[model samples]
Target: MDERKYNMAEEVKVFSTWSSPFALRVIWALKLKGVEFDTIHEDLSSKSPLLLQYNPIHKMVPVLVHNGKVICESLVILEYIDETWKQSPLLPEDPHQKANARFWAKFGDDKVSSIWSDVLMKEGKEQEEGVSASMENLKYLEEEIRGKKFFGGETIGLADIALGWLAYHLVIFEETLGLKLIDQEKFPSLAAWEQEFANAPIIRENWPDRDKLANLFGVLREANLGKGTPK
Candidate 1:
């Protein structure tokens, strides 16, 4: 009566969008577990029937369809993947340590989302305020990961997966906005962590194309803030 065992005949499919950090979390988690899964690239503007059927409430990408069962939300999917596969453990063994990892993961999601909605989408004073808030969030994380190579420890783990966007996508934000959000002087530790995270073999291989992300963010910034016209 092993909960982790699944029939080999069952299909493992992930409905995801290429540019979504949320979907990337699922991809990273599955890859870390060495779980082979088929990916279905989804168009968020006009989502597919399968995505809608699998995730009726949110109908978002990163919907993991295991056999016929569906799991939504990136963090939830990460935990499920970890539990299902015992290799390359994502969460710590100790209960207290596990809770700490979960806490940081949740914090990373909140801060990243805030930067998107408040900083990237706003202008002038409001954007300035958002930047300040984002800095504070990064500072807290910088202090947390000062001694450790990664959030969970020496190896990539749940918190690292949660904060993966900061390592790659944050550059797109800085480039598109023409502002320095996480600089060496301000967030030295977090800046270093970004490099380390991006350079990891698995992450380096799977990271989204930089030029494409830059173009996408540039278009999004123009649409939201009416900044430089998107090329």
Candidate 2:
């Protein structure tokens, strides 16, 4: 009759790298769910055997091993967690709402990385296009979250977790690139939502150190600039 005994049967292992936005996606989901997990930090420079074994395709970190079964791809892993544990609901019960949330999540996932390219590597037309795309994506998000506290509507859900990568990781790009994509006056809704997200204890406590993340961005930017990979 003890719930604690039942909880012990469900355990998870997360393999992640420190500087990966994709890895942070899984971390935020786990933290939001209040799920106790064993975290193994992987050195991306030298791939771990365990990581390679779990994710033979991409072999990337942010691999969630639940009850000995491995789930890769941060978004997919999040869906798996939500389906497995219903304690802290990450997705909506309504099918329509869930679909809408997934749309925004996909938008952010696909377009947000381009902002990094804009900030770090490309110049001239390529950089301009990246900036334009980033702005358009933010505009869509602002419209979507106009009256809602979170992307999933009212409560922090999977979409919020997916887009939360921007909350911390973007500051560095903003600084390094000298771009201010989110203007409070221009996008008041998003600005307010960002504050709400940061104030949330789960998110606040889990964010990467700003200075450190910024330094990493600087290094990556320099490398990408040299290689001309921004486009």
Candidate 3:
């Protein structure tokens, strides 16, 4: 591990929502860095003043408040945590390897929203187009994972952490959207990656219950589809 940027702080505080994939990213990063922090669960429906104050721009959850300084954006917070507490280390030691990891991390961050929007937004021609684009992105990722157990190599690292949200949360999106985007036969690498991602002790233990998340997704889909009173 490289020298830490921030030391001497006894504890850190994180503001987040349990069901959010963005929040899960922060949780995974902190856990990987072996950082002990207090978690403040926020209600998205009723945003707290502190949450708004911490993230004035987006007012979103998954804000990291470390030593009284607030940091918004999940990916940015992950990098901050990595730089501040370099114990286990999220990024690689080599500069080139770190660049490679950051590249995939950026790709996942940039394209995942479109994938979710396409999967959860519409049907017919629009959905078909979305699925096609989503598959293309997934294909690139599958090739990236061709020979490695995880994105960072033999172990999970920044790229895996960035992409981790999709591993568990995507099932809800797929079921709700009725899209077969990641068929096991078609994308066996990512299929296997998802199982490994979900099985990580920190990930498995920290995630929102699958049934609960599925119910939430069902509600969102029904609301979007204008039927069933959002189940």
Candidate 4:
């Protein structure tokens, strides 16, 4: 544990949006590490000046400010948190396993956004294509966690935190869109893992408001696709 690197007295702030999965990733990581930090929720419609200043390039939430230095991007922040606070290890101790965890975390990051936009946001033919692609991507993940309780084995880890959206928010997406993307029959392991992940103590405690998220997604889907709310 390198406590010197992360000054306990200095400010540790997380600029994030409540509905953002990326932001939730940081929140989970911080909670898992038992790091005390202040959360500043940003209104994505009109981002805050602090968010812009901290993450000039992305201009997005989940910007972690430690002391005075800023770390943007959820995965990067997770890594920074893990490195800075080594109490509850987020990554595997073995180098090979750690690399594998990073790989899947990156995979989840790369694929989840597209899945949300294409599958959840779009409709008709586009959404059908997105569903197929998402299933394929999820199949790969399913195999990765085929027998484990979580992507990080018995306990949650970096990859599990990275893909936490799948456990919590994806249900809201399904309800809002009235689509079943992660069926228990189709992706049994992944589906089972979802329940286990969401039921975890820290995750359950910090879970987002389901109805609020569903309503938000409903509005976003309508605005993005120019279609009335799904039945």
Candidate 5:
């Protein structure tokens, strides 16, 4: 919390927010690698001067400041973490495998907008179409993850950390809106991965408070739908 403390001992510090899955990615990676870092919580509503200085362009959370060098973007931070800490690699050694991990991570991010615009913020035929599109995208993942417990075999890897947002976000979105984004029976592998991901010790510990997120998104959904923020 104190600026002076940052310069005192630890070389790693993360600018973060409580509910952001992006921020959590950084936290998970650091913990997985057994890196010690201090987290400075940011209030997005009132942008901090320190955060702005560290990440001048995006001015966002999950900014990794190591030895006075700043790294912006969550995905970039994950890569940085992997490279800096040799223990518990988030990516594989094989080039082809690494490429595959990057691909799936991008695939997951590209789908996020659709969830917000097409599914979460729509209704009637539009919402139905959104759900269908999501399921179709998920089907690809279903097949890919069929035999493995995680995206990169048994251990959590780049793709897992990158797309980890979905584990909690989709569940909260589904519960708050009463819309089924995923049918566990239809997407058994993906469903299993989601459950396994959320329950994993590191993930479970770093997760945003479930009830808090549920309430926040529930109100957000209502506000977005012209439901006037349920009293």
Candidate 6:
């Protein structure tokens, strides 16, 4: 908390939604930095005026407002938070290591968006193919883990926070879609990482109500499959 940047009069706020992995990333980063902020939950069905004003182009949840300046995009916000608050640094001090962390962070996000999202909406042969590809994508992360406590070496950092969605979304996908996203028997390290990351105190405390989120995903799954209501 740099005194110049941490003004007592300034207010920090995040335009968020209940089930947004992106929004939650911003929240987790803030908590990690020990920054006090308020979350204004948004109904995506009806986009709020402020949210639109803050993020005119994307009009998405996770529009972070600090003082009067607005920040959009989760990954960008994570970098911003890291720069603003120096304590418990998110990226490494070594330039080469920091660059590597950024690379993997983007890789994880790309895989999650491309592989997992496609698999979520697929079924039958297509779904099988998607799941197989997803597994292959995760193997890169498995190799990256390489017996380390986290991607950040010791504690959670940029790559860990960026990929934290797997800790929850994979679980949700497995439960709702009945697809095997992570197999502990094969990818022991990734499985262990997910369990530890999901249950970590800060992450766990901010988790959305699973019952509600699971029901939501179940409904989405049914819709994607062109089926009747979920059981």
For TM-score, candidate 4 versus 5, the one ahead is 4
Q: How close is every model to the real structure, measured as TM-score?
A: 0.92, 0.92, 0.91, 0.93, 0.91, 0.93
* Candidate 3 lDDT tens digits, 1-231: 222334324558889887888888898888777677889999898999999888889989789988888889888888898888767788899999999999999999898568766767667788788888888899999999987788988788888988987787887667766667777999899888888888989878888888898888877766776775743
Better of 4 and 6 by lDDT: 4
Question: Using lDDT as the measure, which candidate wins?
Answer: 4
Q: Which parts of model 6 are misplaced by more than 4 Å? A: 1-8, 228-231
Could you give candidate 4's per-residue lDDT for residues 53-86 as a string of tens digits? 9999999988999989999999999999999888
Per-residue lDDT tens digits of candidate 2, residues 1-231?
454466567778889887787888788787777677878999888899999999999988889998889999988998998998777898998999889888877888787667776645777788888778788888988898899898877778988888886776775678777878887987889888888887789888877788888877777776766853421
Show model 2 residue runs off by greater than 4 Å. 1-5, 227-231
Q: Write the per-residue lDDT of candidate 5 for residues 14-63, one digit (tens) a residue.
A: 99999888898899998887777899999997989999998888888989
TM-score of 1: 0.92
**lDDT for residue 88 in candidate 2, whole number 0-100:** 82
Candidate 6 C-alpha lDDT tens digits along 19-46:
9998999999989877888889999988
Poorest 10 consecutive residues by lDDT, candidate 3: 1-10
* Candidate 3 residue runs with Cα over 4 Å from true position: 1-9, 228-231
lDDT of 6 at 144: 90
* Prediction 4 TM-score vs. true: 0.93
lDDT winner between candidates 2 and 4: 4
How many residue pairs clash (N, CA or C atoms closer than 3 angstroms) in each of the candidate models, in the order given?
Answer: 0, 0, 0, 0, 0, 0
Whole-model Cα lDDT of every candidate shown, in order = 0.87, 0.81, 0.82, 0.88, 0.84, 0.85
Least accurate 10 contiguous residues by lDDT in model 6 = 1-10
Q: Tell me how many residue pairs clash in candidate 5.
A: 0
Q: Assess candidate 1 and give its lDDT.
A: 0.87
Q: What does candidate 2 score on TM?
A: 0.92
Task: Name every residue pair that clashes in candidate 2.
Answer: none
Once model 2 is optimally superposed onto the true structure by TM-score, how far is the C-alpha of residue 207 displaced, in angstroms?
0.9
